[model samples]
Target: MDYQIARHNMVENQVRTNKVTDPLVIAAMEEVPRELFLPEAKRGVAYVDEDIAVGGGRYAMEPMVIARLMQCAEIAETDVALIIGAGYGYGAALLSRVAETVVAVESDKDMTASAEATFQSANYDNVIVVEGDLAAGYPNQAPYNVIVFDGAVTEVPAGVLEQVSEGGRLLAVVRAEGKVGIARLYERENGVIGHRDLFDANIPYLPGFEPTESFVF
Candidate 1:
């Protein structure tokens, strides 16, 4: 399949039409080859509007959702970014274009290997892939200028929020059981963190990040 043409249509039809107006985000989305991040069999559908499962209960978020979230984060050229549950590193590859450095964390070893190899092969030198617990943000390089949860989460962990630098931005899709997901943008200002809902999304939740069940008496 002609991925470049498919990618162009994805940006113009799926991404841009969905209110993702950030030029930087659009350009990065356009430049990154989404097909390379998927399994060989799934590459043909890489540019489709729905999320594609990438193994280990992870889904590469749809293009519009990711692009909108990235636009909400307002990534800057000098920002140090972190991508939790980075999967095959497609989002990290896109973030590498605008952020100064990208730290992509994934728990699945196979995905980690794929992400690392893909980054190296694509000459995305600014991205660093690490394997670790998805709930626990990479503290080795705490205080990132921008942080993104690559998929939906039941809730945002306080520990991860603590990792955001002052005036930094963090983006995530928060969903609860039987409830719709909402994309939110969190910002740290004067040592306090606040968030506002940006849009509604239904991206699949990242593994192990689901909220615990509450039993009724």
Candidate 2:
């Protein structure tokens, strides 16, 4: 399979056509070898317009979703970004090229191990892969300039929000009422958060973010 051609099509048809015009984001997506993130059997489908499963019932978001989220974040070269669900560290690698540092969090131990190996193999020194619960964002490296939830979630975990610095930005595909939309949230000065729905999208649901039941009085 011509991975380069597929990546080009993904950038042109999936990303640019969908209004993801950030040059840095486009270049990062084009340069990142997505095939390296997927299992050997699924490498051929790395550039396809679909989610590639990365175990633990989670999946890498499709190219359009990733591009849209990156565009929304407006990643800066000096920004410190946190990527939830690192998978095989593809997103982290992409962000590392644009951001000053990328702290990628993965809940699954196996996935974290794989990501660490991939990072070492690729000689990526800026990406830090940590294994922990997805709902609990990495606070030790708190006050991130940008926070990216790599998969869909029913709600933005409060712990994750606490990790964002004031005026920081967060991008995630939020699932509600069986519909998924890319939601952008910003931290405000008054210790509050504001959110805006960017666009509808389909992304794999992240573990530990399922909605809990409530009893009516």
Candidate 3:
């Protein structure tokens, strides 16, 4: 398959059309080889407009969704970024090119191992892949400039929010009322969080963030 052509089409047709006009995000989507992040069996469809399943109930989000989220995050060259569910490190690699540093958290051992290998192979010096629960953001590298959840979640884990610095931006697809919306959240000066819905989007649900059952009389 002509992966390059497909990637280019994804950027021009899907991302740009959807209002993801950030230059850094467009470049990252064009430069990063999405195929490298998927398993060999799924590499052929890497550039397709669909999420690539990465096992353990996780998936690498579709390119346009990721692009839109990154654009909303407003990544800066000097920004320290944290990527949750860093499947195969594709999102981390993309952010690494735009941010000063990237800390990627992955819960699945196999995905973490694969991401580490991909990082090494890509010579990504600014990316650190750590294996842990995705719901618990990497706190040791606290106060990140930007936080990106690679997949949708029913709720933003408090643990993840605590890792963001005051005024830091967080972009994630949040599920509510049987609908999913791209929610952009920012830490306020008063230590409160403010959120605004950007657009409706469908993304794979992140593990460990499912809504709990409430018993009723």
Task: Provide the lowest-lDDT 10-residue window in model 3.
Answer: 180-189
Off by over 4 Å in 3: 214-217
Q: Which runs of model 1 end up more than 4 angstroms from their true locations?
A: none
Better of 2 and 3 by TM-score: 3
In angstroms, give how far residue 2 of model 2 lies from its true place.
Answer: 2.8
Compute each candidate's TM-score over C-alphas: 0.98, 0.93, 0.94
RMSD of 2: 1.9
lDDT of 3 at 173: 85
lDDT of each: 0.92, 0.84, 0.85
Backbone N/Cα/C clashes per model: 0, 0, 0
Ranking by lDDT: 1, 3, 2
Q: Compare the candidates by lDDT and give the number of the best one.
A: 1
In model 1, pairs of residues that clash are none
The residue-by-residue lDDT of candidate 2 on 16-37, one tens digit each, is: 8888888999999888889888
lDDT of 3 at 134: 85
Choose 1 or 2, whichever is better by lDDT: 1
What are the root-mean-square deviations of the candidates from the true structure over C-alphas?
Answer: 0.9, 1.9, 1.6
Candidate 2 regions exceeding 4 Å error are: 213-217
Local lDDT at 54 for model 2: 64
Task: For residues 49-115, write the lDDT of model 3, one tens digit per residue.
Answer: 8888877787888888888888888888999999998988888988998999999999889889998
